[model samples]
Every structure is written in structure tokens, then in C-alpha cells.
Target: MSTIEQPRPATSPSADWWRQAVVYQIYPRSFADLDGNGIGDLRGVTSRVPYLRELGVDAVWLSPFYPSALADGGYDVDDYRDVDPRIGTLADFDEMTAALHAAGIRVIVDIVPNHSSDRHAFFRAALAAPAGSPERDRYIFRDGLGENGELPPADWTAAFGGPAWEPVGDGQWYLHTFAREQPDFNWDHPDVREEFLTTLRFWSDRGVDGFRVDVAHLLLKDLPETLPSRAELAAMDRTSGTHPLEDRDEVQDVYATWREVFDSYDPPRIAVAEAWVATPERRARYAAPTSLGQAFNFDLLTADFDAGQFRRIVTENLAQSAAAGSSSTWVLSNHDVTRHATRYGLPPLAGREGKQGVEWMLAGAPADGVDRELGARRARAATLFLLGLPGSTYLYQGEELGLPEVGDLPGDRRQDPAYHRSLDQGTWTYDGLGRDGCRVPLPWRASGASLGFGEGAEPQPPHLPQPDWFAEYAVEVEDGDPDSSLTLYREALRLRRELQAAETLEWVETGSEDVLRFRRPNGWEVVTNFGGEPAELPAGRVVLASRRLDGTLPGATTVWLAP
Candidate 1:
């Protein structure tokens, strides 16, 4: 690798960089329109690094900028070494890395190890080769033709929809947990492992600080197919008939393989795994000290509305994570899911409680399909929940502005295959809608026209106009407003970093559903009231608030008190 001895920028200790450190997830297409193509490009992201630095994040996790067919929104890599032309060229990526490094902000790219697009050259070569060839072993291919070659050897459901197995040009079958366009790679193959490591070195040599590995748990599945019995399948409520629980014990070897590769790089890098399994145990396992540096715990994202629910989720994760690994990650929203605002809002109630029942009553509501006012409260409340936690926190792009889910459409309206296959043919109920709502264009500068995110020079008439509510809530607009959401976030970040507020903190339920108390050994307390009822809070010092509470906690008040 060639060397470019740019002045070494000072970075915080690797161990402590995560604390009080914010990470912004950039969904390339919606971030900015660089070529008038309506899609965000690498240069667009490079141009926005200054904006990210201003947001107080130490690093930015750019969602897959690699060569892809876009079958899975860039998750399906066709060539791991190259950058996609749709987003930008390799030169653009170099520029991005240099700029981010110069600004003291690290860059973390996504490496999808579990699968690859069907059009990938390796898979194509395997397809043309005869059965039992060395190349054919690189992927999982089955030749059993019991059910007209359409049925797979086992009864596994594809994550995108339908069966997980599909027939290629020949008489053989290939396994894909997502769209048929994506073929699952056999990690058991030595060549497969080498390819991933080389890919890591390719970008690491290009100055990528680290990686946010995609679907880390799915990289290795149960071997010898363990299908549940007919009666057991009927008794269960989940879509796990063909799950790989049988081979769960041996899956860590796959993670260990990646860890070995990351260890080879200088200055030691970080890896954040996306453990998408149902159980917290599996998620915790991926974050084991010997495994990846961090694995996101979605339990925080799936908590109930009350303080008790939040407490239980936090307590459970912290306990499990402490036992399994020293650290874990917390996330409220991401590209494939609904915005927090839409997920936590209560529906319109005709009862006497009115909108007051929104948070508590609708705690389980999916983030994508909620009403407006309830969405805002839920979004802001979620921010408080995320920042006050003990572990590292991840903020999806546009989360700070409290962006809500975009409305669903019928027919070609929906782009996410996951939503289309499972619920209402593409439309999701409050529970089933997975990620369609959060995938819309970001509301950046409120030109009042789709928040300035359209593809062409002229904005589309039907474009979801930028959330006007953000005019007062954006970074630029809120720099002066001491009471704005943007300001609250900035202050919370500053407190978390400067005062070490979230470190070594213990959450104590103050005997009130409306009030949440966070106590630290340093004689500090953080209280937040999600309810309409006011509660007496002990006096110390006010650290931050969504709205200034008049004497006590009123409805929907969040106060950070230090004693």
C-alpha cells in the first residue's frame, strides 16, 4: 500500500472514543443529489462531513458505498473492492476518507459478509461450472429435485419473502435468505473467508477507520438443516421454521474469522455487528470481548412506553452485556425501520385521557405508522432514552430533526422487499412494517420542497416536502434557539462528553411512571417525565430539558438534574 503522510490528527483513546461519541448513519441515496441524478453520491457525503462534525459526532458510518446491484439497497455487494458508480468512483471515496480524517472524524464502512448479489462474478462463474467443481463449493448448491426444482431442500423462508431457495439457469438450486437476486455465500469455504479479509484490507489500506458489519449473526447458519416438527411449527408464533438454531454453538467461528482479519490492520479498528436474531443472548455473544467490538441490542428499540418498560429493557441488556461482554450498543432507528417518532405514538383516542394516553398506551406501536403530535413526543422522548443509557448510542441519519415515517403507498409505491412480502402485500400495520418508512429522503434544508431531496433539478410536486417543523429544529436554525430540539441534542451530547454524565450511571425508578431518575456515583441525577402528570423532583442542578418545567415535572417533561 502506498503511503500519504498527512499530518496525524489527534484522536481520543480507542477505548473511550465510544463514550459520549455520536455516530451518524448515512444512507447514500437520500443524503444529497450530486450529479443531478436525484441520488446522493460520494462527493455529496464528503461535502457533508463538515455538517456531521458540526453535529458533534466523532465518526460517520457510511452505509455501503461498494459496488452493488442495489438489490438490497447496496447490502448486496457484487464486487467488494470497488465503489459503485451510482454513488461515486474510487477517487471520490479516497477524497472522502482524506477529508474525514483531516476533520478528526473517522469513517466506518459497511461490509456485508452473509450474502452477495446473484450477478457477482464469483457466483456467475460458479453457476457456469459443472457440479462438484472447486468453484461450485464456494456457494451452497443443492441438486435435489423433489418438487419440480422450485422447492428448496429445506423449508426455510427468505427474509425478503417466499422460500429461501431458488433455481438458477441450470438444474441446481441456490440459497438466499433475502431477494433471489442475492445468493448466500458459504463462509465455510476457505476462499470465502480470504475474500472478505482481502476486501477489508482493500478499504483499510484506503484509510477506512473501521466497519459496521451487516447481518453479522446470519453469516453462519445451522448446518444439516434443523426444521421444527409439524406440531411444534404450528405451536410457535414466529417465522422461524427453518432457523439455524441447531448449529448455533459453532457460529462464533465465523466471527472469530473476521476478528482475525481486523487484527491485522494497524492502529486497531472497531467493528459493530448487527445481530438481528430474536434472543438477546445471540446479540450479546457477538459482542464478546474476543468477538466484535460491539453488537447493537434492538431490545432498546422494542421497549414499551412506560419508565418501567424502559428500565426493564436497559437492566436486561446491561446485565446480559456485562456478563457476555464488557460493552454493547443501543439504537432507536435505522434505514430499514420506521422512524422513532412514528413507532412510539399513540393513536387518536376518543377517551377522556385524549392524547395523554399516546406514549403509555401506544408503547408497542410500530415506529412507522403514528400520528404527528404523538410522533414528535415519541421522537424527542426516544432521544432522551438513548442518550441517558450506559452503553454507546447510534443515531440514524435525520434522527435529530425528529423525522417521521413517510406514508405507505399501494403497488409500485413501496421499494423495500421485506415490507412487501410479509404484511398487506407491501403496506405494514403498526407492528409488521419493518423499514419502509425510514428509507425516505432526509429533510435537510427546508426549501419547503421535499426538504430539498428530489433527484432532478426541479423538485417533484408530490415529493414529501421537508418537515417544516424542522425549520426551527435543524442544526442551522436551532444554533440560536436555546429551547430547540437541536439545541437539546447538542447540550445532551456536550454533557455526556464533557461531564461524563452517561458513564457509570445507574437508573433508579423514582416511584412515578411519569418520572425517570438516573443516578451516578458522582452525585448526579437525570429525570424525565413521559406522562402528563407532574412529579416533585429533588433539587440539585438542571442539566438539560425538552421544555423548561415550571417548578415541577409537567406533562411530557424531561429534566436532567444533578445533585
Candidate 2:
């Protein structure tokens, strides 16, 4: 409602700001609550612009705030152009964007292009129209395989679980890669493609800095004859090749068109694809010059905490970025999976692939070899190591406060479709499968009705309950402590901005195999000791350390040094 200065354009003549920018991810529903209705909204996010600016991030990537049925946590969009009433209105979004820009931070909103909420106008029209009508062509509607049409058209399973196809009467079934409420759009349709381009322009015209493309790799499906069963597809190695319905070659053409719209702006807008494809080479294609600017490199998220594993993933990711002539985007956690703090604390599980690793983490008992202290320590070190890397990095909401995954969420409070889907498969408990844990509202104050997340006459409860231990990790508590995780993040980000290193990484070998060391083009060196013993620091002055350092760096610690 008040006048605010607009942020400078994101583009720079000499360098791409995104190449090494630190982007903070804000999950709106859980970020902060202004009206105290217990849900976070656009105005809530607007009020936090100063907090982000103080944290020293170049941009803030807000998850979807569009009108939705809340199925799949707003991923199933009923309308992409309008904001969900629960979040705020278009005016609120403009206010938030202006406030962020005034704080000198760019804005990147999530764009879910893979599917639309079944309640969407287009989907609703498709459902009411005759099977062969043009209206029905907007989505992936097909005839049943059985004579009576009782059987699903394909053997594909949904990513959340259960059958990917849901029956919709008249021997017709619609494809939904996620929940049944989310119907996959037919990318092959000329109208569908044009609609998304219009959506892109709508936001860019409103001053959005960029977009984080949801399910970026899942726009196109393989030819019917080449499609494989869910079982066989699951067994295949993702790092070796592509999947039938995921990351198909046709997806690139869609991004190329989106890229054209981005380039039309004065300071070209950017996009980062959430493409979880197989192989770094395949992933690199998504970040090609004519496609999206960046694709999330998630190898580090699943890599073992071992030094060797980290080195291999880092090297491969850097190589992939070089091949594509684009800077890689590194991330440790997001809304879809377990938080890194709890994950790093668990014992490494060998021979696990794909979602199996996440399952193993979720199934593990707190008393069964899981150490929260160790996990926190490793997470801090991991943060320093990741921030020191060559390219841009993303920090999930509440990660800066050293938040751990709440694995023991009550079944009644569980909202993720994965949890309900697991129940559908006859699993009694959906403990780890659901993503409600990491989606909990942040603890801003040590004590409050909702931990200072909301302000209303009545104490507004968070969408999900915060654990009893959350108070200890509250922002107010950590903000006052110099050694707190929040402080560590703030300092690390400040130094990263100061260094402004070129996009290059060179490994510096330490004699100990457990110690990983590397130097950046800005004459900054980073060292991490994964061994049980201390390792001598590289020849330089220590600028920042994840933990207190004496003459040597302690095990499970990292330090940034200046030559």
C-alpha cells in the first residue's frame, strides 16, 4: 500500500547475476502469517523482505501461490494467472514483488506447467465434453484397455503412488503423473503451448525476475509403442538414460519457446528447471543457452556424506555445467523430500538408488543410530562446502535455522498426497512418505501462539503443528547467538557476495583421503575434514569456519580461507 523503490534490473553487462547468486526459497504457506489466519500469505512474505536482504541473498524463489485445490500442495493449479485466496490476491503479489525489489532482491515464482488442477476451467470443460471433442483434447484422456473399459489404459504408476490413470466414466481415463486431482496437460496441443507462453508474459510484465519451472522434465510423454511399464521403468538406472514419460527430447522445444519470452524483456528474465533426469549430460540439456537458464543439480542431495562421494558429484556437476555453457544450480533440500539436517544424521545406506534412499531415511528410528547433534554439525559443514562451490546455491525455507525433518507427524495433520497414496497401497503408516515434515511453519520467536508466525486477536495455529523442540531453534534465539546456524548462514552469504568469484573450481588435494579441499578463481580456498581427526588448514588466513578452529580444522567441519 505504501510507495517503495523498485529493484534494479537483474541483468548485468559483464556477468549473469544468477551464475553465482544465492537464492532463498520461501514456501509461502509456511513462511509467515500476517492476518493470523494461521496460513502464510503474500503480505507475510512482503514483510520479510528486510530479513532476506539482511541475509544477503540476491533473489527469493517463492513456491506456487496460484489458485489451487491445495491438492499436491498447490502444484495442481486451477488458475495460473490468479493467486490462491488462501495466499493473497494479485494486488498483494504486486506489493510483495515491489517490496522485495525495494530490498534489492529479485523474485522467482514457481511455474507448474506439467499439469493443471482437475478443477481448472479447461479440465472441467474437458470432462463435460464428449470423448472425441476438441475440449477433451486439452488433457491426456484415453479409452480404456478392457472391452468393458474397466482397466486403465496404461501400466504407469503415479509418482506419489497407485495407478497414474484415473477412471472418469464412459470408458475414459485421464493421466495424472501425480495425484488424481492433477490432470496432465497435452503438451502436443497447440493451444496448451500458447497458453503457457501467455502465462510467462503475464508475470514478466508484472516485474517478476524469473521462474522456477515445476516438473520441467515431464511435459512430454514418449510414443505409445515405446512406453514402458512402471515396474520396468523403476528398475532402470536413471543416471544411465532417460525414462519414457520423463525428460523426453520433445520437452526442449517447449523450453526454447519459453526462453524466447524471457529474452524479450529489457533485462532478460531467467528460469530454473526442476528436471530430475538421468545423467548429468541429460540434465545439462535443460540449461542449454536456448532453453532454461539452469537445472537443479540434485546429486549432492543424495550423495553420501563421504568425501569421495561429494568430490565425485561436485566434479561431475561442474563438468556438466561447462559442457552446457551454463552455471549449475546446487541445492540440499526442498519441499518434496527430507531435510538435509535429519538426513545427514542417519547412517549412510549403501546400494540404495532413486527414492529408496529417502525411504531408508524416513524408516529409520531416532534411537537406531540416528544422531541429531551429528546431523546438525554435518549440515553446517555441508552448508559451507556448498556455498563455496562455483555456481548458484538454493537455501530452502527454515534451513538457515538448522531445522530438521519432523518424521513423526500425526496422520490427521498429514496433507501430502504421498501419505494418502501410501495408505491406498495398504501401508498403515505414511511416516516418511509424506512431505508435511519439512513444510512446517518456521519458528520466528522462541515463544508465541504460533512461534511469532502470525499476528491476530486469537492465537492462530500453524497449518501443521511445530514440535516441542522447535523453540530451541527459533530465529530469535539463533539470531542473538553468534555461533548459531542462522548467524553462520548470514556470515557465509555475506562473504560469498564479497568474494564474487568467477565460475570456476579447482581441486586442492589434501594428503588425507577424508579431507576435501578446493580453491575458487577469486583466490578463496575451502577445506572440509570428513575424517575423525583434525586436518591442517591450507596455507592461508581463515576467513570463516563452520565450527571453531584451532591450528587445525576439526572433523566434520569446513572453513573458508583467503590467500
Candidate 1 per-residue lDDT, tens place, 71-125, comes to 6778888999888897799999999888887777888899888888887888988
On a 0 to 1 TM-score scale, where does candidate 2 land against the true structure? 0.93
Q: Assess candidate 1 and give its lDDT.
A: 0.67
Q: lDDT tens digits, residues 283-397, model 2? A: 8988898999889988887776789999998888888898998998889988876788988887685754455545543553343446888988899999999999999999999
What are the runs in model 2 whose C-alpha is more than 4 Å off?
1-15, 225-228, 231-244, 351-368, 427-431
Candidate 2 at 170: error in angstroms?
1.1
Candidate 2: worst 10 consecutive residues by lDDT?
A: 1-10
lDDT of the candidates, in the order given = 0.67, 0.84
Q: Model 1, 443: alpha-carbon shift in Å?
A: 2.2
**Colliding residue pairs in candidate 1:** 38-455, 336-435, 337-435, 342-367, 343-366, 343-367, 450-465, 451-466
Q: Number of clashing residue pairs in every model?
A: 8, 0
